[model samples]
Target: MAKRATVADVAALAKVSSATVSNVIGNRSGKVSTRTRQRVLEAISALNYTYNENAATLRSNKSNIIGLVIHDLSNPYYTELIAKINRQLAKKGYATILACSDENLESQQSYLHLMQRHNALAVLLCPTWDTSGEHLAAWHDLSPTITFLRPVGSHESDFIGIDNYQAAYDLTRQLIADGHRQLAFIGGSQSSRLRRQRLQGWKDAHEDAGISWNDAHILYCSSSMSAGSAAVMQLFQQTSDVTALVCYQDIVAFGAMNALHYMGKTVGGEIAVTGFDGLSDAEGWLPSLTTAEVQIAVLAEHIVDRLLARLEKPQEPPSVTLLHAHIHWRASSHGDVDSSHAR
Candidate 1:
């Protein structure tokens, strides 16, 4: 019989320490240079060595696993942010586990419970719309969590997100300036804090401009292209005067544009459209999209930094960090504003 391979054998073959080999094999996302990691992987393959993850967890008393919980996994902006965070955590010697809530409270509860069973080192959560202080307290018992986008409870807690209010306000104000009086605030979660903040901004902008907005124009839908398309159709059925659409995000904006095109309406000429989350796809839209850019890289750095800090000082008072948004004007907002305000 052939002798069984071991971590020591792989480490020696790779010209690295046994611990490094264990880190590579156990977590697959540990603090190692890309070259060194590849070398270790090759060595493991050559040796046919495998380590028991349960035994490793028992030995280390830490899982080296980070849980990422979010509402929608399909959004490009969120996906980009997750990729950056996954890379950053890998460099810090941690593996990531993702759980999508699909904005459902029950699903969020199930995923959080699963993370608890794994004894996750920490969690980065984009909270469900219905999350409350009581719910947060229950979750705190499971893992240290740093929330983003939607925050719950009055209790001090770690949170990092963009200024939803200001972003919406700025974009709506610009659309109003472009002679769009009847604007529809489209695509929002049922009752999310971020949604409320954004809706308030849109309303406040109308008031500031001395324009009255109809309550029926405020339409709520999931943050999805199909949902956005349906919402636009429904809104137009309700009223035809809505010349501008203040979409919740870029994906929704794309759907709105597609719907308008199907209706034989010339976008940017007769009707204007604007959205948040300056996703790359927005720029490639036929007429292009005007949006508020929330820097994902910056948000990831802040999120990871705060996560590490939380792990270090579990008892420290919680804090909130709101990142800035840069507005990019394009033909989607107005045909003339493209040259004047495009970024």
Candidate 2:
């Protein structure tokens, strides 16, 4: 094996002190002659020397890296959001360390510990389904942490998420106006704060309209296309009177659409389906899904911005930002009036 060159070797060849070589490499010299710097560069090139990044980070107490914790990478929503976050963070001269929890609380906590070991300056978390204040507090004590898509309990940390409750409420209300009285909700664990908000909105809308809230219509499923499809099937098997379905996510809506197609039923004509998280595929679906368009890119940008700001100023008060979701109407629903007019 060949010996690796060090700064001392370059200094010995350049006839300069190691400090001079360090100054030249870091471009921090003010009094060193340009000729001296040039000679150090030439010696470095001859030695094929590389700076020790780990050693440098150890001295600086920073890794110049941020941690990103998401529930699942298989979902297109999180993947797209990560892409946006990566692009924006890279522009700020930072890198991301990604971790997937698979909606498992234990797995998420383990990843947080790993991130802390890596000296992550901050963490942007898409919390697990069972994110409690205790879990968030433990992570926050390790490093500056911010909640992205899903909020963790009510801990005072930066939170950036769409108004899931209002979005779901509006979608359900749209269905109600479309003559969909017997509605069903598909996907999402009721324990999750985000899911709870959406469910509350559904209940509020029905209650405001003087309609009875039916517990049997609410179906809990994982946020997946398969889950959505299964929920639709289960709903039909239990009660065939469901005229509209409100999915917690667009992927679930996609699954329900597939289930409807497999059952030889028309999506828009036979039953209306609305989804949250306006995924790109929603626009191209056969019936063009009606959904709440969550500004994912904007949300990612804001979350990164907040996280970086917190990293720069840790003592600052925590921020809570709620972005609104726009309801996009298409052929999936029966209403012809624009949402703006309904509002």
List model 1 lDDT by residue over 1-343, tens digit each: 9988888899899999998886776555756778999999999889888676666787777788999999888888889989999999999989999999988888987898888878788889997778876776777866788998778754556989889999999988888787777888998776777888889999999999888988999888877899888998888888877788999988888888888988887788767999898888888888999989987888899999999999998989889888889998888876543332232
TM-score of each: 0.82, 0.87
What C-alpha lDDT does candidate 1 achieve relative to the native structure? 0.85
Best by TM-score: 2
Q: Give the per-residue lDDT of model 2 (tens digit) for 1-343.
A: 7899999999999999999998997778595799999999999999999998678789988887888899899989889989999899999878889999998999999998998888888888888878887888877877898987787768577888888889989998878876667788888886778888999999999998777768899999987889889988988888877778888899999999999999887788778889988898898998999999877788877988898789889998888888999998989876343333232
Per-candidate clashes come to 0, 0
Best by lDDT: 2
Model 2: which residue pairs collide? none
The alpha-carbon root-mean-square deviation between model 2 and the true structure, to one decimal in Å, is 3.7
lDDT of 1 at 55: 68
